[model samples]
Target chain A: MLPRRIYQFFLIYLLGILVLLSLKYGLQLSDYVIPGPKTLWQTALEVFPRYALDVWNTLQVALIGQVMSIVLALAIGIPGRSTTWFGNFIKAAAYNVQAYPIVAIAPIIFILLGDGFLSRLLIAAMICYFPILLTVLGVMSEPVADVEHFYRCTGRMRWQLEVKIRAFENLHKLTTVIAGSATLAMAGTIVAEFIAANAGIGYSIRIALYQSDLARILVALLLIGICLSVYQGLLEHTGSLVKKAWTGSA
Target chain B: MNGKTGKRNSLLAAAWILIVLTLAVAGAPEGRAWAGTLNYRLKWIYNASVIGDLYASGKGYFRAAGLEVKVRPGGPERDALRELELGYADFGVASADQVIRAVAKGAPLVVVAQLFQVNPLQWLYRTGKGMIRKLDDLKGRTIGITYGKNDEIIMRTLLAKAGIGRGQVEFYSVRLDYTPFLRGKVDLWPVYANTQAVFLRDKLSRAGEETALFVPGDFGVRFVANSVVTSEKLFKRNPELVKRFVGALLAGWKAALDVKHQKEALAILRQVDRDTPLRILKTQLEITRRLVMPRSGPPLGTIDFEGWRQTERIMLEQGQIKAPVKILSCLKPML
Candidate 1:
């Protein structure tokens, strides 16, 4: 029997294809506006070889930004759970950062950082930072009292108790947050590229829009969707594995 | 409490109705006399390039022709041709490249009037850095282009004609900002000669620097620029409306190019685009006049058939279009 999750995914995918087919053949929309799936496939075949560099560039930006954001979030979030003024300040700053719209501020970020890889990286990192940081802070602030008492009875140091026991206990949450942030990182990287970048999938999409090449535009969008889906699937798999190992159950 | 108060209320309601009827009767002639509403989608934001369209509306030309025209400004993502295709706009301004590409894709679009006699796509380089006196000077220079833009086509055509190899020069991709050129990172940058070139020259002159424009027209690539366009369905459905709109638009163009009406045109343009400085608008208007009505060319708004044919040939040679788009069939000049 097929897995329930697998069945659901296929159902959604087929529904998407159905809608596209209806738009193309049923409604008889112009090919210029909405090209059929066959044309899109042909365009992908033609564009992918030429767009390999763009794919690689976008992947690098997203992956690098995701890793950096995770590290920064952990470094700040653990200490931010402390009952102190500085900790409260850090918490407040993270909330503030989440309030600003990334798209509106992207141009300002580009101006300050200049239009290059660093600007794109910073934009992606900014987007990925808050969710991971907030999740870490939430887990740390609500540590299990029994675990704390047990560690205290064992005479463990504060750093050791917090880092070794508390973090390990919340491994599921951390992995889940990381999984979620991965998607945001990819989206942010693409948007940053759109605002200012010479090479990336976003740049290719912009060029396609200017040329009014509907086939190429659809191909670029499909590639972006594929990239995000693959990354999310890997992250989810890793997250499940971590959960299973930590809890000693499937 | 019943009959007296009800009679007073009825009297007040009747008086209000009489007043409304009087107002409607007085305003009906002007309000109901409009022939139709024309949604004109411009190719870019309100600037000197669209001064003629703005001028026509400002001078009551569209209204005089019994039409209510809504002049809409376009931006980076706002494609005039796309708006026309989607039925949101009745008339639009698009470049020859856009029109050709749309027609090639079976868009059923037709060009009604050519705005600029000469294409405005050109390269701007600092004269103080190094003069591009000859075609060979372009070799080894870092040239900036917005890939997939008409400038790319024009530049490639120029290079191919001059026998320059692709590897001879580096092509940089330009974005919305001009910082790369301003920072000396790019040797040459593409710009609309009449619009952006004026602003760049003014900015550079203030900094004690000089810049020179490399017009592709001077290099034998006379691609047509912005032209008024409408869908074939609309053109066939109401040719009279098309003719009236074109007539008013061309008259506005003539007036805009005339020195006597320059002040009036600039005034109208400034009302739409207040951010641009007055001096910059003057300079832009002067360059725009030269482009629209060259000393030794056809009068303003004349559709140059040879120019369109050459543009198509260049696009074909560059492989931008896979097949020939019947250039003349798409051009229906009502002016």
Candidate 2:
């Protein structure tokens, strides 16, 4: 028997294909509106080689932004876990930042930063920052009474304990947050590229849209989906390995 | 089988039939008893650039031609040709360069009517800050360009022809907003002569500043601008419909450009786009009339094959397109 997760994935894809086929044949819709699976596959094959550079450019921006976001989140979120006014202020700012939509903020970012790689990086970081910070705050604040008592008995500094031990104890949550934010980072990068960039999958999509090349647009979207999935998959796999090595579980 | 089993089978058959019927209805277009529905996707937002299209629809010209027209506005993300390809739209407006590139990529599109006889794309620079008496003045000046757009292609071609290297002029990436240009960061900015340039000029004039327009045509480039297009399949299958649509569209253009019908055309345009000022619309209409039907040029909606060939040639030289797109085959003149 197929594994449960694989079977579920297969079933969803099968349903999508069935719907496309029904639109193509049952209703006799033109190929322009909903292309058949075969056409999509052919388009993917044709455009993948030509657009590899755009994909790589997007991936680089996303990865760099993700790393920057992680570092910034840790710097602020760890201190915000403390009982101080500054910490509370930092938490409040993160929450406020999360409230504004990226689309609304992107044009302002472009104007201030002058439409360069920095603007794209800042946009991606802005999107990835809040989620990671909030997750870190949640994990740090929810220390178990028993764990706290044990750590206090050991006489370690509270900040040191929180940073080295408490945070480590909740590695699973941190990993999950990081994995989730990867998608947001990718999306933010694409949005930034769309508003202002010299090169990227987003730029390619814009050009393809101008040309009315649906096949190229579909290919770009597929590549983006594939990029995000692979990134998420790797993070999850590595996260599991780290969790197993640290906690001695499969 | 028992009575209950028989009843369940009958219900299942009915459900399947209902599902099929619903799907069919959802896929089909909304029923039109007499007039054929034509979805026209414009290249840009509802502005002076698409005044003719708006006029035609608002004045019942399309209705006279048996077409119930829906003039949809396009933006940065909307590709009229892509919509045409997907059957979301029956007609679209795009630049010659865009049409050429699409055809080279195997899109089944045919140009039916050319709207702008001379391309509206040109560079605007502040004359008071510095004079650009000759092409050499462009050197060392910061030029703003929206890369992957036709302006970028035109600018690069101009530079190459002028023997100017990439390092001579700094290229700034242009966004939809003109803050950088307004703030004097960019020395030269690209604008549609008949549309955005009118608004920019008005604002600058109010600030007691003067600007000089640089026409690419004057500088040795005659690339065609917006043109009406439809799928080749439609052109082949419904030649009569294509003829009627083009005839009505050109008639609308002629009226919109005529001085006598200026107020009516602008009124029609205002009905669709209320944001643009009346003064700007009047100036834009004047400029558009000149561009669409110059005193010595072909009439409105005439497809100039030589202009298209030049556009394709420029694209090929710039490596914007891989190969020469058969320009002649893609053009289907209905007027």
Candidate 3:
């Protein structure tokens, strides 16, 4: 029997061919000329190098956004969870903000913060922040009566206790939050770049669409997929390292 | 902890503190001094109409009227009236026929002004492709048209004129793929004569591709395709703004026609149109100039009332519109 990976690849390839066939013959469709077979080949050759660069840009934005989100989420979650007075209000506000559509928010962000790396970063951070915040808040809120009692008996200062016990103890939760936020941040960056952009994958997609060239559009999408896969791999590697360190130390 | 660890921790803590401080300081809403910004959702991509917006901006006509037009280049996914209805755009340019559809559907949009006096819809093919001189020649031949109600109505009318029934001709959705006809995949394709045809012939001359164009006007089908428009409610509220905008845009259109400025305008068009060729661009410019400056009374940039009536008659006959539209009511007289 063929290897499972090869089998799956074959299946996917067959399905793609079927789709192309349907678009061509099944619907009795008239194939468009501009981005037809010849144009597709031309674009495929021209776009490969540029596509690699765009993917790099996308990855860089996503990374910065993910890191910012994790930091902001931790800062918000820790104090908001520990404090009683504004805890519910802060959590509700965060949730409400998370509910706003990325597409609707992108234009406002673009206007308020001009098209810079910082603006796109902020959009990515905003989109990714909620998942990390919620996850960190949930993890921190988990009952740790024994640890609280130990800290109380030791008469440790709040800052010292938080650093040694709370922060160090929740490494897994933080890593998971970072991983999830990184994925969301990538999505947000794409949305932000789609509006008021001069470069990046989203801008390329927009240009392709205006010219009504489907090949470049598909190529852009393919490049994005590759970029996301690489990012996910990095996230998983970092996550596993963190997990290993935490486990080994214990 | 080591001295290095202490320094790194202090830097991180300071950064966090700085972020919080910045957030607090930036939370206050700034006063709206830039309130005169007019968001315009264009009907299509960076084409002639989009260049018109650029020209209008460059000439400071919009600023002279105390407005800053933000021209948002639109696509197939965008709904211009929907953008206007949602207050995303102050006004937009779209088909006069769309105005009838919008009004019938209870959409609060009205025609504020007209742009093109004649629609540029045409059936283009490579010459000597199986006797395609008349409409009946389209019978049993593969025809390329967009899969829209309006396109269908236009094709059906043209087919009927050629003494061909619906079943005789095969309707294939072109989806703006201009090359399929050149590749011999289909016999005929509908195109915007000013835009697509120019791109095909002029832009790709070096590529050695050839095309022959047949227009709907030549076939006794005449309609105005694009018009400057605003919401009915917005029109009632800010009639002066609409008037100023129309005047400014007319000025922009006039500037586009100037022989001296045509090169500058073409340069801007070329910058935006990476795919279109120089031949196509010049062809579009000439064709558009002819249509806009038809050899008749009221030199150029004038909407024909009879043209609107003819469009409505065709649309109504084809069941594209429910009720008859009054052409005079649709016209916003140039002040």
Candidate 4:
């Protein structure tokens, strides 16, 4: 699965670069507009070590943020799953909070938190939280009536048991949602870095853009794609491991 | 259920294909012209700095020249030089760094006019916190600069010129907000002398704080700022149109910056820059005149050949560009 994910990313990234190169040669665009292959390769060699470290720093923040969001989503989703007034209020608030664009709120976050790890973590968590929250809410609220009815009738069903049963029944869905949110978490971190933070691949890309070096930007994008692919693959692999361990499957 | 899943996947695949096709079509470059139409892109957003470009379009100066020019606003993200090469724009305003960098990369870009003879990008410092009377005064100062922006290059050059190492001063990364500067976390903050400087100086004064500007040009860091640029093809293919367009554009600038035309210029600026109060806008225009056209300087939109060479040399020395672009050859002053 990890190899496939990495391979797919390479395919798509190369295709995109191919299209850009086609545009460059077709329209006779200079390296300034879309860098030639030699320039791009040379830039990759020049900036790889620095950008690699930047990507790793970004991934660390994104990992912590994703964990926080997952915890936060579950904490809220479990409580907000019921059809009570408070539950509806919680749902409404979450929906409304997600409506505010993160880009618009990022400046405020950076101003209050400073452009450090905290700001990037909050932004990543905020962006990665909403989708996970919605999914968790949807999954937890849903009932496995056949199995749940038997548990309730036998007086064996507690709130914890109910959540476990629902989550167990929709294990594939929960796994998929968690794995998919890795992209959002990474993207959120990059956006945070691009907007304010002085470190990370996004900041490097911003510097490249300032210099109008498309070659450097292309190299940065290549590094981001590879790191993101591996991270997302790891998330999916971990999700599958949890499922196998829970079910005691082969 | 299987059929439904297949249908959904098919829809997703179709959507992806449509997106790819749309991207390909949009990315293809062609000199899009209709009825002698022209598109002129700016280096930055609609502000006092672009009074001439705005006035040219607002006052129908282009229309009088039998050209339907669309005067587009620009931002930091906008690359007018790239647009010119892409055929998305017939003419554009690019910084000297952008032009030099582009030329070094073999981009067929030519500068037809230099808008600001004196680079307006200056550092704003609060008065009580000590003055930057000389380059060494910048030592130990927490200077604010946008890392990838022209400000960083200029600041680095300034520091080098002062024989100051990076360790001497705290380099603060500037963003959209000036909170750090306001809260006294940073000392000298970069601002456009005409636009942002005017606004920031006013805000400081109202809060009972005196402020002053530190212009790099005064200290002999004559990095060129904005200039009118065009593709070599357009400049060569249609010299007549280029001449008329630049002529009319400069005329608009001449009129707008003229003391006699201040009333009319303010009225024109008011339409686009509604957020800036008339009082602030008036002061901005006044400051712009000194930078753009001094008493002994060449006419409005005049290309300063010596300054262009100096700008290229600075970039070479700083290693911003790997090689000299022979920037003078690119300066084809239309007038």
- Candidate 3, chain A: TM-score against the reference: 0.81
Give the number of the best model, judged by lDDT: 4
What digit string (tens of lDDT, one per residue) describes model 3 on residues A1-250?
1244344444444444344543334222222311345545676798879977986887788889888888888778876676577877777778888898866666566556755677778888888888888877877676466887787788874754654466566777777667666668878777666654456676667655543445677667666765665666677677877778867742
Question: What value does the interface RMSD of model 3 take?
Answer: 19.6
**Which residue runs does candidate 2 get wrong by more than 4 Å?**
A1-57, A71-96, A137-170, A199-230, A241-250, B1-35, B129-137
lDDT of 2 by residue, B1-335 (tens): 89999999879856765676567558655322224578899999888888888888888898988888898898877777766765778889999988887777667899999999989999999997577766777899999887778998999988888899989999987876787898898989999999989999999999998998888898788889999999877888788888988899888888888899999988887887699889989999999999999989997999999889889999999987778877888988889
What clash pairs does model 4 have?
Answer: none
Error of 4 at B279 (Å): 1.7
Docking level of model 1: incorrect
Q: Report the Cα interface RMSD of each model, rounded to 1 decimal.
A: 12.0, 5.2, 19.6, 2.4
Tell me the TM-score of each prediction against the true structure: 0.85, 0.78, 0.51, 0.94
lDDT of 3 by residue, B1-335 (tens): 99999999879866765565455435422322225787777788888645666678777878887777887787777757756664567778777666665554445666766667667777777655564667777777888865433555677788777778768978765532344565566777777778776666554454665567767777788766777777665677777777888788778777876777899778878878867667667667778766665556354446667777777888788776568756457566554
**Docking quality band of candidate 2, CAPRI definitions:** incorrect
| Model 1 segments more than 4 A misplaced | A1-21, A24-29, A79-116, A137-173, B1-36
Tens digit of per-residue lDDT, candidate 2, span A1-250: 1244344444444544555566556544444555666767887787798677798799899999999999989988888887799989988888888799877777687668867899889988887878898888887777766767787888864776657677777898899989889988998888778777777887788766654556677678666766677777787888888889888994
| Per-residue lDDT of candidate 4, residues B1-335 (tens digit) | 59999899878866775687568757687765434678899998888999988888888888998889999989878899998998888899988988999999989988998899899999999989787788989888899999877888888888898899979999999987888888889999999999989988999999999999999988888888999999999888888888998998998898899999899999989988899999999999999999899888888788888888888888888788887778898899887
Local distance difference test values of all predictions, in order: 0.81, 0.81, 0.68, 0.88
Q: Write the per-residue lDDT of candidate 1 for residues A46-66, one digit (tens) a residue.
A: 898767668668978999999
Best by DockQ: 4
TM-score winner, 1 or 4: 4
